[model samples]
Target: MATEDDGVHTICPYCGVGCGLKLKPGEEDGDVSLQPWFDAPVNEGALCIKGGASPQVVNHEDRLTEPLIGDGDGEFRTATWDEALTLIVDELERLAETYGPGATGFFASSKVMNEENYLLQKLARRYGTNNVDNCTRMCHASTVYTLRQSLGAGAMTNSMADLEEHGEVFWVQGANPAEQHVIAHSNYFREATRDGATLIQVDPHANKTTRDADIHLQLEPGTDIPLLNVVLKTIINEELYDETFIEERTTGFDHLEATLEGFDMEEAAERCGVPLADIQEAARIYAEADNAAIFTGMGMSQHTCGVDNVQNEVNLALLTGNLGRPGTGVNPLRGQNNVQGTCDVGAMPNVLPGYLEVDDDEARESVEEVWGFDIPPEPGLTNVEVSNAIGDAIHGLYVMGENPVMSEPDALEVENRLNDLEFLVVQDIFMTETAEFADVVLPATSWAERGGTVTNTDRRVQRMRKVTDVPGNTRHDLEILCEVGTRLFGDGFDFDGPEDVFEELRDVCPIYHGMTYESIGYEGIQWPCYEEGDEGDQYLYQETFDTDDGLGVIRGVRHQDPKEVPDDEFPLVLTTARLEEHYNTGTMSTRSPTLRRKTPENFVDIHPADAEKRGIEDEDYVTLRSRRGEIVLEAHVTEDIKEGVVWTTPHFSDARANTLTNDVLDPLAKIPEYKAAAAEVEPV
Candidate 1:
């Protein structure tokens, strides 16, 4: 029988597109069905495949229902909430007392809401440490570092509405929005292209985004800096730059010019495996357009020179003076739903709430005054640093909604390190691969069972309503964090619900200070809403940039090779990206029957020539090996990928691409080189 439709509105938790969703409860409890939320903001009722199948996991068979405590061995025994909470609190206190705050690491999750991440970071700082970070460190940490250094804000400079309405050209590089951010592509980008906006795509391998591209520049992987530098050179040589804007609104022009002095554009083009003429033309179109937007992704990040790679995009936007407007800016298409908010609320190692630097005495003091506790001033280790220091410095690990065992690079080593940790605690809704190793597992409510706020890729802060009742005995994530904070620290952690916690978050987070449940309404409000009556901005940096000098920073960057280059033994370059049907680590997506049937397991895309040489036919099971480890999976012989490069994704648990991904991080951003590696294929 058809149940009465009691529609509850929320945001799609799949991608950063933040498509609005309307959920209806069935006759039974926890039976939620997805309905198109017509006139709801963002995607306008259109849902992607991933978003449509999201409700399947709300009542999945694998849901974590109760608290669990690990025995002396690897086995686990079900325990009451009291027993589990006590063990976790005791272990955390003991670790801090014995090895100090430096011995513990806290990982916030991008999958969670802004309110939850804020509280987690606050708890970490209140407990006396800044050693906290999220999955952004693996994807867009470099983009954030570069954007913060150059433009004063690490998020997208333009909103999707403005980009669709005013954008004349879309210059996309290293990102596959059509495949990854499906809703964003379908509604905004694909619509914009049909209406006359030019689509210029630059990627190592052709994918969904390439189908709509007016210009597809398929350059080699790990060579983003070189390709972008060539575009910069063409703009400078042809005098295509906006001289007035460069002179008045930007700094460091001379440094850029000096770096590009006598630069050989032809040689750089050859090095990146892209035609020089195509790169130059793409540059000319972008520079000449009235409003051109740049969208970058993990292909530009996840390298030793990830910072430099993104800095060049900044250089492109600044030199051409395409920023400070409705549609023109460098927009990093974020991978996860709340990754942007995770950084904005200062869940990382370096920043406090509101992107305030931990080392800054004034910033630290301001936050301390509100929290009633003195925070650690020095910044601590990143996620990778914590992993590398697992046995030596970090004795305990706290994970929330993140499966680092499958998410982090060098997965085999990460698993071994996780096994040796003294104490491990995980708070999530499902029995994740990482949760199996936890000493104390705290079951938390799913997104459909909670209400909170999450900031999307375009800096739009929207509200998500609880669509159903909590499954089994699971508690809310906010409640779990609150209990831990109250039991351990004894003050500041007492919160009635999500609204109460959000009120406290607004008190310290300046960007969110003006927003409340009533204010955030259905349409949602873009941030930089500093005061109650102030309407949020549609685009940032209109008159002056947020840089210290109030001018856009312009600098040139040189190309750098991947840390692990292909050798005779490993003769193919292995690069990783996400698939349309799967989210990262396949934690929630794989559990859905529709998504599972669509793409059941991992597969590698290889050039026909390479597969032929390896005696591998289409759909043949192959062993893909790198310097670190190997995994067996089916191979598809195709020319979609370049001859020397092999492409796969990081979604499957049984066979993850991260097993072969190099862990050499970008020195400044601490992001791993998950995009490129050296590997070989053998028929299994």
Candidate 2:
């Protein structure tokens, strides 16, 4: 970011495409432009509305400048940096003394840079507790869990570049890339369609991405497992499955086959509300492809059965021998910039940094040698469990760069639990919904105000350069976490900056052994990269896996019905998602006039037939209710949504969908029932 330099080369802050950008810094104090870099390999001179407006978000007026402490009287007043930090430390220390370390919990931000996220997780571990989780727990934890169960690792098996070379069929389910991940959809859908590749889409609603689909299975919500099982049965019955691949490359097919013996195509068709012909067509299309890919979104991973949805997708891929090849694998498009990086850094509670399970003695010893502390051997509570346990025994909560009030499931329950905590500290760029519940809110810098490396959805690491000076008393999240940690644990916690933190992170996390700012340069290298001299492949697990036997372990996943199903009282299935205009929680996108203007408010999309049946018209104010809670939103009558179901974006404050979302979680992954919550909509 030199003054004399013509343009700054950087990566797009939005989506997994990780498009390279030529940024022209603001002339005075507030200006930004997207000068496309045509030579970039990922996205060549093209960006969605998000990528074009990313820089503008950095200089938004709503950016927090100074720390704010909630005066015991319920009002937040401005405070000095020293005052805020001291107050937070004193309260947290008091909480740790009164209650055990397990009583306190921490939640990291997915949008935070990799270095900052690494520090936040480290601070939690050093505090002698594993009650630390991130946005990934709610979003893609199931995807990671299922993939790791089936494949060797929890990442995209192929690179985006592979979409151009080898893709005969693209089965995109539960993902609508046209709105959220626009650039990725453009590259894969456009290229695959041009080459006459078959495109099969499975979703409750006919989303923007479904426009290019050759076959669209508009199935009933929460029936993903039944539909997927039908496809697998079709693959086996029609002799479309790859017998050789299933025999050599995978295990657990016998159990899966036995489970499918009872579930025939007709039963699945009845359950999923799709025609038998359509299900069979989709199965044939997928099985016939020489090279195929499965691209899923939050639609699959945000449900109580989120893990099972992803596990089925993987089973299909493995059965066809579509994995470990170019453009043929399961790709769960991540929402945030560093969600992959945050997970790779092991920011989750149950795992040490680098995804090494905390309970593993060998892994704990490795991290212990580096940090010189005996790591915890027990697995900690997940996010929802942590908040639920707050009032009873949990006394303190240290949240960094996360707004769980509007984001987490069962908002009312979360608010109640958070209010019961004795001490609560929040570090964020804004006084968000979650921060409003905090005793102390520490001001932190945004992405543009920091320099570090972030891993994208495809596991591609890229450098994030600091372009502007942090405003007022605000500081980077890494510096804040380090300061608080030093105060609590003494001077042993020493690090120069993000680079030093990254060096230690790489040393502990073997997947990132070869990555560094110097070696990666502007375009960060992909993980499992080994080092400079070693080669980086577009695909993983070509020959063997990183498991006990060095082979891919396919789990025999049993299909379980959703905890909540549509009944006489709640006859409609409600699905939650993000819009093209707003990112998660509307903290960033709502601040931008351009993006905000496009989506001024949130509205629920109901099928015209359903609306008419309920005597509701477009724009009619209605209350959508579930067992958790209820929310009032205007109705959007459209055919895009299937009958007996409704759709709404979860990025607005006025219509916080999480309020009505059930907190019942998957037994394995612990993800909430976000994809399909049985709720009835009534016109006011």
Candidate 3:
């Protein structure tokens, strides 16, 4: 299957590369192609494997056109929109009557629009419960939590444009952005490396990003804190600390210096599986650099100690005075299109719009005034907690866009919980694996068929036009959300369109003051957007932070190991990640034949030696068993992974990698351990 036209100008739907793509419309009927954007701000002319085949998804046949309802016989049946909505409303009312608001939870999707995500959170809060969460919880919730705690801001400090001008080192850890955020990495690494910026990669896997690195430290998993601590100790011992910046901008040098005293190179070397020489070299190079930057992905923040891992990174940056400057701050390469926006608009259970806490009386009062309703004061359970509580107590769940059955850890348990639920309503563009268990499925429009705004990784809100019509009877997600909200609660939600929602959001969310649909026209406006003559700061904390004392506080952190460790029986550490061809859960990417053909099924990415020792060969069907469960897939033996570690992408339900992931979550972020788990791999 090939495409009809050469391409249409569009944005990449995969990573934060946000590459400009030329989408080739189907020529013969059901094919599409994509090419590089010659004039993109980020990617001038390039595409990753994900972006290269992004156009194929819009023309995918498996995209759902009709609503689906799970009949009593463990099978889904096509149903009209009205019928499905009616059934869901009836069941929701029943659940509301039987159990209180706590029994009902809502899980919004990151892959949707900012307006829809905002509305979903509004519905949850207005409905008198905080049982709301999103995909951010699984990815960068730890990064967000740690940044908010330490810096009083929960976003990337510098824009990707900062990667253009650099004179220092680029320290990339916990992510393979070269393959993931292809365009950004190409510019920063491939293009900028020629200009003299040293690249340092830190990860267990010898990924694409590591291959071309000036220095690649293959550290052990869950050793982020120890390694960072060792670096900090080296910097302190060798007088590499930024004295002036620490004296003026920061407040916790004495305590931090004292804390780093006990952590030596020998202890850290053994703990982190990095040589003392390499640790010292990395530290010296970073300290000596004119403008060093730290870029992190989910690898650093998807563990039981996820918050600590990120805090350590931030601590490292702040110690070296890498704040409130250009090309010198913590830059989190966000996992999804509006992960930053969703958090900005209050998708998390604990926070309101503009990262305001629900427990804060002032913030609660502000939202209450705008909505004209008394909002709840208590914080809510996270996504993982809601999943664990599904069968235990929760009666109904309204899932929008996300396919948790294929993505959540201990997925078999998640399926059982969904099966046990009194009612499960899923709203998505396709009949996803999670939707297969839904009592009612609402067909929603995709990115191409919807008109709204999405916040990019840099907090730059971009306009997404309705380039294509709704595939069938599928409606915009916001409309469905409003309809369901009106049916459930009364007159709280009365928005006409995405703009109306944005106006309301800006009114209540203080950081968005003076921001309007008109102001944010065509080119997006970053938040902290104020009126003319009231400049909006790009990097925060220039004058002071948003804390009670107007100063950022350094929360003490302790190094903790992962809950699941490699043992004799389960000798290999198995981690799950996304591929360039497929996104999370693969509800859209996998539907595309071209994308599907690139990587048809899930496979175990094992080291060559490990495969040989186990009598396994490339493309051999192998069974990877963890304490939670087991999954059989084809083995992809390569040197990309370490000897005792294996990797798999969690995009396929036929071979879900999450089924074998440990459900242990970070105590602070409540995010599950998707990166590291103990598993045994053998030929199936």
lDDT tens string, model 1, 32-84? 98898878779989988999999999989889898999874668889999999
Clashing pairs in 3: 3-27, 3-31, 4-26, 4-27, 7-23, 7-24, 8-23
The TM-score obtained by model 3 is 0.95
All models, RMSD in angstroms: 1.8, 1.9, 3.2
1-684 in candidate 2: lDDT tens per residue? 222176666777666667777777676543566687776556777888878788877777777888888965468999998888899888777777877678888888778878888887777777878888888888888998988767867888887778657888888888888887787778767777878888888988887878888889999887888888888888988889888888887888887888887776787798888999988888988898899999888888988788888989988998889988887989888888778888888788778776788999999899889888776788777788888788886778888878889888889888887778787888888778888888888888876677788888888888777666777788888889888889888954578988988898888887887777777775567778666544456788888766667655555455567788889989988888888777888887777788888888888999999999899999999988888888888899999988888888888887789888888888888888788888888997
C-alpha lDDT of residue 448 in model 1: 91
Choose the strongest candidate by TM-score: 1
Whole-model lDDT values for every prediction:
0.91, 0.81, 0.79
Worst 10 residues of 2 by lDDT: 1-10
TM-scores, all models, native as reference: 0.99, 0.97, 0.95
Choose 1 or 3, whichever is better by lDDT. 1
In candidate 2, residue 63 scores what lDDT? 73
Task: Highest lDDT: give the candidate number.
Answer: 1
- Poorest 10 consecutive residues by lDDT, candidate 1: 1-10
